[model samples]
Target: MKEIDFSKLIVTLVQPLVQEPSAITVTERDTERYREYVLDVAATDVGRVIGRQGHVASALRTVVEGARNKHINAKKIRLVINDHRH
Candidate 1:
């Protein structure tokens, strides 16, 4: 899978866990230097995606990083969980 696939994966993973699956948004940013991914969850369901003790978020980062390594495009990638649950 490619970068966009990761975004889709986030949606797929979080959709069933939340009441409003449509509220999930995965935003990607690319620059000459690096690519950044931000997972945005609904204010009401942030806890679901994050899980307990940040384990879910860490797992997400690990998966994306592993995928990037396999693709080996020589790019720096950052996966971020931007909690907009305020």
Candidate 2:
């Protein structure tokens, strides 16, 4: 399996989330073998992206894992969705 850089992979996925009117912020915590991704998006957009019952988030996680598995040894990857609605 080819090794991948988790940090760069995260940035690539997160960059597009911020393009919409709603603000999207991503923070990453990196360790020797794992990385975590925290994604904060406007509440309105959250539904649009995450879908009903979190299917969207689950799909995204799958994609991330597939990509990561191809190259790097990742212990875990987390996606935290922050709602920005009042």
- Candidate number of the best lDDT: 1
Candidate 2 ranges with C-alpha deviation above 4 Å? 1-22, 31-34
**lDDT by residue (tens digit), candidate 2, 1-86:** 66766546655665564446436667777766667777776665777666689887787777777776633553766666666563
- Residue 64 error, candidate 1, Å: 1.7
Q: lDDT per model, in order?
A: 0.76, 0.64
RMSD to native, candidate 1:
2.6
Per residue, candidate 1 scores C-alpha lDDT tens digits across 1-86 of 44446677667777887888877888989878777878787787888778899898778777777767546556776777778744
Pairs with backbone N, CA or C atoms under 3 Å apart (clashes), candidate 1:
none
**Root-mean-square deviation of each candidate, in angstroms?**
2.6, 3.9
The residue pairs that clash in candidate 2, if any, are 2-71, 3-71, 4-71
Q: How accurate is candidate 1 locally (lDDT)?
A: 0.76
TM-score between candidate 2 and the true structure: 0.62
Q: What is the lDDT of candidate 2?
A: 0.64
